[model samples]
Target: MSALRIALADDQALVRAGLRALLERQGVEIAFEADDGQALLDRLQDTPVDVVLSDIRMPGVDGIAALERLRERGDRTPVLLLTTFDDSELLLRATEAGAQGFLLKDAAPEDLHEAIVRVAGGDTLLQPVSTEPVRARYRYHADDAPRALFSEREVSVLRLMAGGYSNKEIARAMFLAEGTVKNYVSVILEKLDTRDRTRAVLKAITLRVI
Candidate 1:
């Protein structure tokens, strides 16, 4: 396959320059660059790329707003959000806004590379950020909603799923047969009333269940 094409967006020119160099070193193509979320949206008017790598916070038309507008326009182009901020609420907002993936800006090169590939190839990612704070905040509101209680094991599986692990990896880590993991995942989906893993995990987050 040809190198993966990516559109880069950030307010800091230095950050964009550094990312361009790092991505090029990894055999990734920089299809274009943009200074902010609005620029990213404008570029998308014509340029087509495999993935969109963007910072969460910017002056005008921040990443979340950009993503919302993209989806609002019925554009499902895969978007992977990057940020230096450690705010869990922001992560929730980004994921809910239809970002295919979310990662800290300090993510290792190999990890970043993997995220781009996964998002480009049609996968959602949460990157294992500790959502404890967000969960704590969301719990207050979650209490008012009907809850889907999960077993201890099920919760473990959901966390790993949020980390973007496959069933085989989850089974290996949790020391269970792969089939058993599948059963757990099925139960999770049924409990969350989701038809798929991505929606299950997203719902789990929205409900503060994981």
Candidate 2:
């Protein structure tokens, strides 16, 4: 199999170097490196990479802005956001901006590698603890008026998603086919005006739909 090509974008030189060395040791190719979002965008214009690993908070053109720009320009390369912030609002915004996965900066190297592979394969990855508090915060404020977009089934799926269940697991739990579950998720995303599952769940909670 061909090695996965990846780009590293972070303000810290040491962090970038360590991640590069670690991924290279695992046989993944480092396509390029950038210290900021703008530099990453410039490199992306010329290099064909499978994934981009970016720090959520950078000096200029932060990860969230870069993510929106990438998607706006129709770049399909998967982006995995590494953040030290576990704030639900930040996580929600990152998802809305189109991040494929979210990982804590302190996550194990193996977990990082696994997240990259999963995102490259078109799957969403979210740390469990990272998502729990966000979910709880939403559930705690359940008395607010409901958002007019999601259907009952979609809300159900989003609740399960906030619980960190995979699509297959959700299908099993809800007694629906996996495809049906995926469709519900897709519709939920559209209605919530968000990208990916994590943002959808966060938005649902913020909107008091779940």
Candidate 3:
């Protein structure tokens, strides 16, 4: 695969520098950098990248507000928030605001790289903190979730997908061939009526299907 290109936004110069260094070592190209949310938005208008890593709190428009604006304007690029470990409330807000995933500031370099890759690859949310706050909020009562419509094995595969397992990993865990796992993923997507794993998981959550 070609190198994954990424855009970064953070007010702290030191933090940005450290992250750039770390992410560079992880092999993704840093397309651009912005000091705040407004700046990030402006930069993104002209630059294209596979992912965006942004700080949740900033001087002007914060990360959640920026993500809201991005979705409002129809930008579907996956975004990962940078947060401190105790920012459960902010994390909850980020989830409600449609953030794809997030990274803890104190996470190891490999963990940070994995989070970015998962989000860019359209995987489900890999939350670093407790999702209790998020669960308590944003409870959707959609009747279209098709609860109990999944077969037992499909439910197992869906749970693994929600946990961000790749087809290869799921195949190994389930003692199935990788091709079989791919087939399962296709069926899961079809049953969920979603084109991607991320949306499928979100829909499942909205309907309490898994």
List candidate 1 segments past 4 Å from native.
140-152, 166-180, 192-210
The predicted structure with the larger lDDT, 1 or 3, is: 1
Q: lDDT of each model, Cα atoms only? A: 0.84, 0.80, 0.80
Instruction: Compute the lDDT of residue 22 as modeled in candidate 2.
Output: 96
Worst 10 residues of 3 by lDDT: 129-138
Candidate 2 global CA lDDT score: 0.80
Candidate 1 structure quality by residue, lDDT tens digits, 1-210: 999999999999999999999999999999999999989999998998999999888899988999999889988889988865465567667777888888788889998999999889877788545566656555544343424668889999999898878888899999999999999999888887778787677568767776
Name the lDDT value of residue 8 in candidate 3: 93
Question: On residues 20-66, what C-alpha lDDT tens digit does candidate 3 reach at each position?
Answer: 99888879899999999999998999998999999888988988999
lDDT of 3: 0.80
TM-score rank order: 1, 2, 3
Q: Give the TM-scores of the predictions, in the order they appear.
A: 0.83, 0.73, 0.71
Model 3 residue 147 CA deviation (Å) reads 7.6
Model 2, 133-194: lDDT tens per residue? 66556543444333355667887888788755789979999999999999988777777766
Q: Candidate 3 clash total?
A: 0
Minimum summed lDDT over a 10-residue window in model 2 is located at 138-147
- Pairs that collide in candidate 1 are none
